[model samples]
Target: MSYGPLPKRIDPRKLAEREVRFESSVDVDQLPRLVECLALPDGKIEVDLQFSVDEQRIRTIVGSARGDLHMACQRCLEPVEVEVAATFNLAIAASEEAAKQLPRYYDPLIVEDEEIELLPVLEEELILSLPMVPYHQDCSIQTSFGDDAGAVDADGAESASEKPNPFSVLAKLKGQ
Candidate 1:
């Protein structure tokens, strides 16, 4: 979604408030890093946001938003549905010290005509909520190996067949 310019000057003396809702679609291919991790097929991003502005040292803003994205399974590389929801509070300060009093992660957003654009910040928050590991909760893939295998020779050692790199006496010698 596109947002208009924010108010150029926010008068600390006056209380400024605004509310907006936006909807937009983002191409999965545009997010190359996230796509590499998810390996998702072609998909779109859906977002819903509700935000308000209040006066603080400079101006304070708060918002709540939710998003839906399509992800790919880590195990079988299949499509999976993912959802994210978050609540945020932000402050725009005239000085660095005033900004520091607010949240460290708060970004300097646009303000115009006593209005602020929150869509960009909301999108970023949604991106941060993505899971480190994206996989289906109930994956359908199965392997032939089961849990019946027991320890080799009763010493709690793995079987020879299970060794990642098996040793061979003949192979150890350079020449025989």
Candidate 2:
């Protein structure tokens, strides 16, 4: 389904009371923190959020955000497109003490005001979803030297086979 642009701020409590579901796209440029993790400033995050009061009377927001982000590949140091997706189950709390009381399954979202900045929340989710080390599946970079197992040294000794085994010393010590 077609989605509109996500609002910059929202009254999550009010939305939860009304049981609102937001389906929208957030611009990449608007999320500064998330942009810092990307190689290029391009792409939009598609988000689907549902706000409601659960059976326990806890106000919560459940949602998923997904997008393709351009990041430098760790293996090749080139731009690679990585798919970032995250799902959040957040329980709204008025204070730190209230947040501490939330169930373990729900992440606490502390808010003291009528409205909260929505982009930062979405940006944080996306940032957490990013891979620690972005790399291509089939990177073109080769990771081997000219060393061969059968090579001999200048003294006519098979260097590879003549290497001392550190474990052998341990075995000798164990025999004592």
Candidate 3:
């Protein structure tokens, strides 16, 4: 996949009667704002978009995007390879006003007489699909707190052999 400029324009009215296939890839750096949260690897997005335009509205956009990212694990704070695969459906209308009248979610991509670029929209969609707390399925650290590990219990009491809190005995004497 190659990261390039977006098309000057995509006439939904012209595509109303037909389907279009948009296959492209975009570099993460090209989207500076979105790169802040995404731990993007040196990779390009592989997108296979298939959709139709109905009059001035994009009816159904079904596609899949695959890419690799480097993100820190939420649990261990270690960097890990993240494989992203997202499938999405979007409706593009002429304007936000027109979309507001629609029942489903709609994104307004204005079409001028120039090339219409889908990179921005694609980036937004991908960002939304990202996991809030990303972690490896098999975490490296062990989390189980066994009794022999000297962990405190729910009642704020340590194991019998553990060091006693001096304040506890003081509190008991005061109670008497």
- Top of the candidates by TM-score: 2
Error of 3 at 137 (Å): 2.8
Candidate 2 minimal-lDDT segment of 10 residues: 147-156
Query: How much lDDT does candidate 2 score?
Result: 0.87
lDDT of 1 at 45: 49
By lDDT, the candidates rank as 2, 3, 1
lDDT of each: 0.51, 0.87, 0.63
TM-score of each: 0.48, 0.82, 0.61
Q: Which model, 1 or 3, shows the larger TM-score?
A: 3
Q: Write the per-residue lDDT of candidate 1 for residues 8-102, one digit (tens) a residue.
A: 23342233234443344455555455455454545654444333454433455455555456666766777777775656655555556555566
Error of 3 at 97 (Å): 3.1
Q: Residue 166's C-alpha lDDT in candidate 3?
A: 55
TM-score quality measure for candidate 2? 0.82
User: Which of the predicted structures, 1 or 3, would earn the higher lDDT when compared with the native?
Assistant: 3
Query: How much does candidate 1 score in TM-score?
Result: 0.48
